[model samples]
Target: MSNDKIKEDLPAILERYRDRIEATIKPYLSLNLTPDENLTWWQSKFAGREKSPGGFPYLPKGFDYPQTSDGEYLLLLAQINFAEVPYLEGFPTRGILQFYIADNDSYGFSNYYCELNYPQSNWRVIYFPEPDLNAENLITDFDFLPEKYWFETTELEITKCSAIRWTKKYAPICLEDDSAYKLLLPQIGEAVPFELEDLYEEFTDAYLKILDNDGWFCPLQMGGYSCYFSDDPRVGFSEEEDPFDTLLLKISLIESGSLFFYIQSSALAKCDFSKVLYAMA
Candidate 1:
């Protein structure tokens, strides 16, 4: 990668590639989560019906808490109550979706690279098509957790129960994905009056800059395109071979990078989470 800063005429570039850019656009939900400072672990155990991340989970009575092969409890990464979300086509109108990952160094992803068939024991996605809305009937005791789900700072223990606020957005396919270059370059070449061979890198860099400037680079999103720090997991597979078609959920963590959950369209429509795929990068 070049260290030298490259700038382009952004307006001209946007006008040139407007059609290609528009074609890649898709709708997504941006998760805005705020933690409640006053919330205690005890309160979280009460299992209120809400969308959150990294707090106590909402479990139905008698529901088995997900665990690893060694019987270690998996931690809640995110819990999405679709009923709280704005409606999106092909997504469940009303349901509770929870993502759990083994509380380990790799966060349940043991592989150095992304792959398929990640053991459910390591990571799991649970969907309750008809979720129990009553908090009283939900599991309320989480004393089994090894430690309080809050971190102890030098000052004091800060307990949190994050509350999610969903904002619907139209996100274009990420230009960073290698496949975007393959798909859009030909379209650009035909549309633009000037040759793009020499200006490819400059154009791509500027496009990213424009996206960032416009505040389209969301770290945590549902649906739309998949974002990555390394390789796109769907790279090797052809369209026919790729079963995981939808980016169900994506949570970006600074410590372990990003967690991506994908599901097949058919599976998502039928509310089958058994075939959901997990990948961390």
Candidate 2:
């Protein structure tokens, strides 16, 4: 409300991703979505309807096209409208963005885009992609979302420091002091290093040992780095930029480590996590 559009960088960032988003959508609208061995899958779904003359079949009617405007993408990915979908009773949609996200680049996407449900510190993806054909949602949604599932806290980094939550305008950054929201590194299911299904037992111990050496004494919250957001109305808002060069969010229009109020999630399930994950990945 003070000067030039605080979110000015958003447009440039979206343009950077525009081509990739467009490229990703090509297959979803055609037979390419079905494997050669399952031609029947495509035939059955489309039935007798022919693809559009442009060679691109749009998503089924009633489905929401992705929000492609510059800043719109930011709001779609980072902000949420709580009035839309009810939170799963135990997993509150609001929480700090912890950093324990699984970094598996072999797949070109994080294992999870996690947020710790406030007060409880339980982790989960609010908008699990509701895949039902028709692209479900936009490639941008898939491009922006973190992995889905809940990671309960095993410890907490209870620090006396004031609660911290930094929001970015068009970037995937926000910090939830590892002290409060909790972050659990991949030891088992959610994110197995090298996709090694057998490392959980040995890795979790080694991981914890490292934390202990770092002065970690939490009895419950645990995990690697994560992003956080504040639900506190008293929390002030700014328009700095996002910290960390997240592969997917690296094109952020926001500066690095700048905290603002715009990144808060209202806990809306308006996205299709499963589809986006599959496509974006």
Candidate 3:
């Protein structure tokens, strides 16, 4: 199909979800953002954001973050005891986002990753990674741009216009309704799983490469406490044939980072998560 044809078709899927999402998914969907629900407020309890004095949507001095994304709660996350994979409450997997949201602050749209906790009354925001917007970065800002299209943006007007266009076209998928919403995941990459030792090795490599310049290249992050199948290393399952039979290594992550771990593949499969997440009771 033509690029224009592809773009045109994408919106219809988005439209269907918006029309019926609120009505069908009564429990998870929210039209308004609340302190109890939105991460901008909840995240304040943990590590605070670094804020500037006056800027787009300005806030007071010493203020860690901008005002709440009150009207912009994008998704509510929760996981079954054993939702899709057996690597419960580990890296890459948080919970399930009821949908998506493109909410951001002056820097850019901040996508919040939340998990449903006990009492089930509120969501625990694991972390939120803000956009790192530098002129150099925008050159590859494909998230906002439509596929099959690209152009240089040395001019400010051309740049602003592109961001506006990308947001409009790309951010609508999160508001999708039930049936059509099922298709959104497959469009993402496949989930690829890895072992803890392997992950640590990769992390060490990245940490060293960027240590001088202060960088971490490893993209995988783990949550929850680590577990082992047995005391013996030989009996443990790191790359077992069965996805469920493997022992889990829980690693704490820098909550501020945007790293993401995946299942066997980062690609989204039908009715399954790409990130193998494990949660505890």
Candidate 4:
């Protein structure tokens, strides 16, 4: 078929197969970035660098829950888990677990990685190696670009896939006491100089990479805890306030791809740190 014909027909085909498509895609999808062909291409850009920021081997800081001398929570890392399960014969097996820390003032480091054949019925557990940890290393800036298309294969079929692109900004966080540590910036890639519409296009393209590549069927989950001072007046009613609180956010996405249904579980802070903080829980 002509490229134009395929383009014109795709919308109708997608509409007609919407239900089936959803069933095929839902089980493998997750938030953040989907590593499709474009992601591979983007990664390739940094592949030849002798000092490339290690991508897969490094773990985000706070993942181990570092504590201060007084035993107080100092930093935390967000955890992301991804997996692929094939019910059909001949399909390739794949999975990953990654961690992230949005830029924060109190934290000093960050890291991410994946697990192969995670959550299997058996006892085997393989932890993927990560890049080296640099105390001065931070995600200085990031750009979530439009999706890119690529080709992939399952045991039963060969297909095209889409993926999202992101560029992160990193920098060193300097404290008042002159103790400095690296920090990931707070802004999303959407705030970059690109046009808003272009940004959305990039995001959609990247997201489609996950779907087209059958990314949605994998079982994936992400979560983390954060502590900071809250100014809620109710906390200071009787005496000098403690001036700090904790917040926790957890999310999980599970999909089967063939059935296209997914469950997203998200939990936010339910109480103050003085009561039932996540660090202690």
Candidate 5:
């Protein structure tokens, strides 16, 4: 069905489970930037430093670019200057954060026993708490990167850059996961009659279908409920056990896949990306 049709039917979905789903609502910053093949790397930086999907990240003088375990340079997946982003809880008010992934076929996702392994060797999340704004001090030469890695996998080229405009919006849970439902059950139960006990699956499916169809779920966002194309990373953990409370970033990949970075609130506050969990779906 078309997005207009789904949007027209959204009211019905909301009215049916208004109380239950309302509690799941959380705000997120929507990144509005379209990748243009014609735009040169210099043109992307014309708007000054900003958030981008794939770009030459802001590298200070002394900092070495992130590399995989094999010592190959990781490609920039996203660069987020928190100064350009709105204030989000548990998120830095100022800093330049970058997500780098391997240029390999797997996009640097390393798995163990068919499950995502922690302390990922192929991907990296670097935080520059105090970004030096001097352009001359940054590394300008990026010709060393392999040319094949620049191709656009989706609409966005992995190597080209596009400046981002932030739009703060509200979102509810998109994917269905038992752990997530259980975690929010208490709050949802308090608002209504615990109707989700019988209608959780049915309601969630219908609601998410509308949201997804209408493009309400962001392919790249910050500090919001994660909308995965496949499985949610924190699906197995219990309510009391917090695997990850912060959705650091989510980047869409080819074939409806996504790369996610999750971190604890405390760790994020400390500007520590060491313990952040990397997941691909």
Candidate 6:
């Protein structure tokens, strides 16, 4: 198959099979997960159970008590040994779907971790705190557009070679070319005029230190900038550092943006502040 065709077919196949996979696993776990809530809900449930002194005793059939490691534990449940799971009908290979659950409650420890692996080809890992609200409701409430979902098209203006045109048109500047900009504009626009004043009061010392270090414009440019692993000759990765750690940090930033946009979009869509605050602490 062509690469493009494979790319197109893969997501469709994954989406089609995702529900069947969740359905098979859900009956064997303590949590009830909707299609949208599957990853986060399962991660939270497993993490909570793993961290507790006694693991969750209420798991359904075919699941075993998780095995504890050095400040972590992993639970391996049912596998797709055959075409028994309805979704595996046409897939060439049918093998294990391992569920790894882990947690650590100590300071600076990773609070939660969950992984769903399909042999070697595809794997997904999620980490987060326990859900304060219903898993389904939390997923629904936080359904904001992903960060990479943006419109990018360049428009060229042409005029007669020797002629100058002075047609007046106004277009608002967009900070991020994504749907969140549209949803956040009303509030952020209102706050823009007062942003400098607010910053002066809220971050006087840090702002001054930034000015001293990198000058006035640096603070504005720094907001959109992110540190990412570079394979480019300049600022390349080091032998000592882990590439996976860099990727995880990058994913964490994306998740942070998604959560922030969801919360700021509406009071109703806001995540439970206590859980977030406690997690940070």
Per lDDT, the best of the predicted structures is 1
What TM-score would each prediction reach against the true structure? 0.76, 0.18, 0.18, 0.17, 0.73, 0.19
Off by over 4 Å in 4: 1-52, 56-264, 268-281
Candidate 4 worst ten-residue window by lDDT:
173-182
- Estimate, for each residue in 1-281, the C-alpha lDDT of model 3 and write its tens digit: 12112223323333443333223211111111111212221121111121111101111233232122453322212111112222322323332222121223211123223221222212122222232223333222123222212122111111111100000010121111122223433322233245344543443343233221101111111221122222212222245443331212121223332312222322222223323323211
Point out where model 1 deviates above 4 Å: 1-10, 37-54, 113-115, 148-159, 187-196, 213-216, 237-240
- Model 2, 177-260: lDDT tens digits are 221211222123334557654444443343333222211111111112223232322122122132211111111111221111
Each model's Cα RMSD: 7.1, 22.9, 20.9, 21.9, 6.4, 23.8
TM-score of 1: 0.76
lDDT string for model 4 (1-281, tens) is 12112222334323443333333211121223332323221121111111112222123443333233343322112222222222211211222222222122312112211111112211111222243235344332222211212111122121222222222111111111011111111122324445455644554353344223212122221111111122221232224232121111222212111111111121112111112111110
Model 6 misplaced regions, further than 4 Å: 1-66, 70-92, 103-281
The residue-level lDDT of candidate 5 at 230 comes to 59
Alpha-carbon error at 137 in model 6, in Å? 37
Q: What is the clash count of model 6?
A: 0
| lDDT, candidate 5, at 84 | 70
In TM-score terms, which candidate is top? Answer: 1
lDDT of 6: 0.21
lDDT of 3 at 39: 26
- Tell me how far the alpha carbon of residue 18 in candidate 2 is from the true structure, in angstroms, after superposition: 48
Error of 6 at 14 (Å): 30
The ten-residue window of minimal lDDT in model 3 covers 161-170
lDDT on C-alpha atoms for all candidate structures = 0.63, 0.22, 0.23, 0.22, 0.60, 0.21
Q: For model 3, what is the C-alpha lDDT against the true structure?
A: 0.23
- Candidate 1 per-residue C-alpha lDDT over 173-279 given as tens digits, one digit per residue, 9 for 90 to 100: 67655457656676454244466655676777767767552223466678877557767776554453546768887766554456778888888888888876677
